[model samples]
Target: MGALFDHLIAVPILLPLLAGALMVIVDDRRRPFKIAVNLVSTLTLLIVAITLLMIAGGMTASGDPARTSVYLLGNWPAPFAITLVLDRLSALMLVLTSVLAVAALIFSLARWHRAGPHFHTLFQFLLVGINGAFLTGDLFNLFVFFEVMLAASYGLVLHGSGTARVRAGLHYIAINLSASLLFLIGVALIYGVTGTLNMADLAARVGDASAENRVILEAGAAILGIAFLVKSGMWPLGFWLPTAYTAAAAPVAAIFAIMSKVGVYVVLRLSLLVFGPEAGDSAGFGAHWILVGGMVTIGFGMIGVLASQGLSRIAGYSVLVSSGTLLAVIGYGTAPVISGALYYLVSSTLTISAFFLLIELVERARDAGADVLAVTMEAFGEDEAEDAEEEVGVTIPFTLAVLGASFAGIALLLAGLPPLSGFLAKFAMIHGMFNPTGLGDGLPIGAGTWVLVALLIVSGLAALIAMTRSGISIFWASIERTVPSVRVIEVLPVLGLLGLCLAMTLQGGAVIRYMDETAASLSEPAGYIESVLTAERVARAPSGTPDPAQGADEETEVAP
Candidate 1:
C-alpha cells in the first residue's frame, strides 16, 4: 500500500493523457462511450486530486514528514530525471483544476459537447497539460506542458464554428504562437547558462550565478516574462483575452478562467523561489515592472468592465482584474499579503467562472441583435423613452429568479462587497500591506500602497455599478422576456462553483490559514528543493527474490 500510494501522484497527469488519447481513438460518433470515458476520467481525477490535496496539506493517513512529495518517472534520479512534485501550491492547483473540470464537463454534457467532435478528448488533453504544468518539477517540462495546454485551448476556443469564434481563435493562436517561440528561446538561454533545467537546481544556482551568467539569465527571464505577461492579460498584451473568452463556448470559457492564472502561478513560483532576496545582486529583478504592469492592468480591466455592454466581456474583464490583483499582491512581497491574494484568487476565479457559465443561459432569451444594443444602451445612459415593445410583469419565473440571484451573487463576489469572501480577502491584504513586519527595517506604506488600496476600492465600485446596470437591463428592462430553457446540467455547474465561493466565505478562517501556510511554504522552498533534489528513498530488495526487502524494519521514508 505504501509503495503503491507513493506512485499515485503520477496518475493526475497520466490518467488524463491516456484517457484523452483513448477517447480520440474512439470514433467521434460514439457519443455515449466518449461521455462515459470523460465522466469516469474526471471523477477519478477529482477523487485523486482531493486525496493528494489532503496529503500535501499534511493530512495523510499515515506518515506526513514533509509537505512536498516528489515522484520520479521511470525510477530516475533527481536533477538528472523527469520529476513531478506535489507541494501545497501544486496540490491546491490540481484540486482546483479537477473541481472545475468536473463541473465544466458535466455542464458541457447539456449541449456544448455536441457542438463538435472530440470535445471530450480536447478537454482531457487540456487537463493533462494543466496537471502536468502544476506537478512538473523542471523548467523544460513546464514549457512542454504549457504548449500542450495552449494547443488544446486553441482547439477548444474554436470549438463552436462561427465567424467571431474563428476570428478570435486565430488572433489568440497567433499571439500565443509568438509567445511560445519566445518561451522556447528563454528556456534555451536559461539551459545554456545554468546547465540544468530542473527548477530546484535553477533556484539553487541562480542566486550565486556568475556575473556573465546572470546577465544572460536575466535576458532570458525578460523574454520569458513577456510570454507570461501575454498569458496573464496584463494591459496591452492582453486585449485578446476578452475577445477569445467571450467567443468561446460557455464551458470552455469557464475552464479558461483558470488558464490565465497558469501564468500567474509560474510567475509567483519563479519570482519568489529563484529571484528572491536570496539571489544576491539579482534579487527582486523585474519586481518593479510586475508591480507597475499589474496596476496598469487593473486600471485597464476596470475601464473595460465599465465600458463593456455584454455580460461575457464583463466577465472577461473581471478575470483581468483578478489576475492584476493577484500579480500586484505578489509584487508586495509579504507572506500574509500572498495568503490573502491566494484567497482572492480562489474567490474571484470561482465567481468569474460561474458568471461565464451563467451568461449564455441568461442571454439565451434575448434578441440576438439586441446584444450589441444592450451593451450600447447600458454603457451610455441613452435618453430614450421606454420601448413600446417593452413588457413589464409583476410575476417572477423560476429561471429569471435563478439568473437574478446568481447575478447578484456574482456582483457581490467580484465587487468585493461585505459579507463575502471577496471582501475578506481584500481586507486581509490591506491589513498586511499596511503592516509589513520583518523586512529587516520597516518599509513605509508608500504611494503605490495607497494607490493599490484606492484601486481595489474603485474597481469594486466600478464592478458594482457595471453589474447593477447590466442586471437591471438583463432582468428588468426586458423588452421580450423568454423563460430560458434551463437544464439541470447547466445550472448545477454554476451553482457548484458559486457554492465553493460560499464555502470559502463560510470557512474563511480555516481556508485563510491554509493559504497562509501555503504562502509560507512558497516563501521557503527548502522542503520542495530537498524533496526534488534528494533521491526518493524506496524499499530496497535483496539480490534474489524481491519480497518487502530482507531486513526492512521500518518503512522506507520518502516524501509524503
Candidate 2:
C-alpha cells in the first residue's frame, strides 16, 4: 500500500502530458469535450498535489516528517539517471501551481477558450512544463521543462490574436529565448566542471572541486542565476513584463503570475542547496548581489505601481514587488525570515491572481479608453462642475456591488491591511527581520533590515492608493456606463480565489506552522542530500516467481 503511494509524485507530470496529447487529437470543433478533458485533468492534478504535499510535510503515516522522497526513472541510481524529488518546498509549489491552474482554466472556459483553436491543449501542456519543472531533480530536465512551459505560454499569450497581444508576445518570446540560451550554456558549463548535471550530485561535489574548476563552476552558476533572475522579473531584465502582462488575456495574465516565481523558486532552491554553509569557499556566494538587486527591484516595482495608469499594469508591477520581497528575504540568510517570506509569497500570489480576474470584470462595465479619458480630463482641467441638484440616493447594481466588494477585498490584501492574510504575512516577515536570531538574542537590527521594512510599508501604501483610484474611476465616476453582463462562471472564480485568501487568514496559525517547518527543512540541506544520494531501487524477485505483494505469476519489485 505504501509502495503504491510512492509513485504519486510522478503522476503530476505524466497525467498532464498524456491529457495534453489526447487534447491535441480531439477535434477543435468539439470544444465542450476538450474543456471537460482539461477540467478533469486539472482537478485531478490538484488532488494529487495536495496529497503529495501531505506526504512531503509528513501528515500521513506513510511519510517521514524529516525525510525527502526521491524517485528514480527506470529504477536507476542517483547521479546516473533522471530523478524527481518531493520535499516540503517542491510539494508546496506543486499545490500552488495546481490551484492557480484550476482557477485560470475555469475562468478561460467562459469566453477566452474560444479565442484560439488550441487553447485547451496549450493550457494542458503548460501544466506539463510547470509541474515537471517543480518535480524534476536534474538541471538538464529543468531546462527542458522551462522550454516546454515557455512554448505553451507563447501560444497562450497570442491566443486572442490582437495587435497588442502580438507585439507583446513577440517581445516576451524574444527575451525568454535569449534566457533559454543562457540556461543551456550554464547547464553545459556546470556539467563540464562537475561531470554531473543532477542537482543533488552537484551539491555534494561542488565544494570538492579543484580551484580552477570551482571558478568555472561559480561562473556557470552565475550564468544560470541570471536566466532565473530575468524570469523572476528583476528590475532591468523585467522591462518587458508590464507590457506583456497588460496585453495578455485576463486568464493568461492570472496564470502568468506564477511564471515569475519559477525563477525565484530555482534561485531559492539552488542558493541554499548548492552554495550553502556546507559549500566551503563558495558558501554564501552572490548573497550580497541578490540582496541589493532585490531592494532595487522593490523600489522600482513600487515606483512602477505609482506611475502606471491601467489596472493590468499595476497588477504586473505587483508581481515584481512580490518577487523582490521574496528574493530579499531569501538572501537575508535566516530560516525565520524565509518562513515569513514563504507565507508572504502564497498570500501575495493569491491576491495578485484574484486582482487580475477582478480587473477584467470591472473593465467590462466601462468603455474602451475610459482610463485614458479620465486621466486626460484630470490633467487638462476639462471637467466642469455640475449645478447642485436635489440630493438623490443612488442604488448600486448587484454585479457592480459585487465587483466593488471584491475590489475592496483585493485592495485590503494588497495593502496588507488587518484581518486578512496579507497583513499577517507582512507582520510576520517584519517580525522575523527584527528578531533575526530569535527573541532576546540581542542582535542589532541592521540598516538593510530597516530599509526592507520601509519598502514593504511604502509598497503597500502605493498599492492602496492605486487600487483606490482605479476602483473609483470604474465604479463611481462612471455610473452612467452600462453594467456588464458578467456571467456566474466568471465571477465565481474571482470570488473563489478571494475566499482562499480569507481562509488563509482564518487558518493563519496552521499555515504559518507549515511554512515554518518548510523553512527549517530548506535551511538544512544535509537531509535532502542524504535522501537523494542514498535512495535505493526496488529489489526484484527471481524470474517467474509470483511475489506476495503482486499476488500474480509475474515478477514484482518490492521496496525494502
lDDT of each: 0.86, 0.87
> What alpha-carbon RMSD in Å does predicted model 2 have with respect to the real structure?
4.5
RMSD in angstroms, candidate 1?
A: 4.5
As a whole number from 0 to 100, the lDDT of residue 280 in candidate 2 is 89
**Model 2: colliding residue pairs:** none
Model 1 segments more than 4 A misplaced:
59-65, 371-393, 438-443, 537-560
Expressed as tens digits, the lDDT of each residue in 1-560 for candidate 2 is 17877788899999999999998998999999999999999999999999998888875455447478899886667756589999999999999999999989888888999988899999989998988998899899999999999999999988897899999999999999999999999998998888888888888888888899889999999999999999998878888888898899999998888889899999999998999878989988888789888888999999999888888889999999999988888788787788888999889998898888888888876777888877776678653446224224667889989988999999999999999999999999898888787521222588998998999999999999988888777887663467888989899989998999999999999999999888888878899888887887778568897534343223222121
For every model shown, what is its TM-score relative to the native structure? 0.93, 0.94
Worst 10 residues of 2 by lDDT: 551-560
Q: On residues 1-560, what C-alpha lDDT tens digit does candidate 1 reach at each position? A: 25776889999999999999999888899999999999999999999999888778875456544457888775556676688988888888998899889988998999999998789999999999999998999988999999999999999999978999999999999999999999999998888888888888788778878998899999998888889889999878999999999999999999998899899999999888878767788878888888888888999999999988888989989999999998888777778788888888888888888998999899888887675777667568675566544444468898899889988999999899988888998998888788777322224789999999999989999999999988887888765677888998899898888889889899999998889888887777777777688756465545686543233333332221
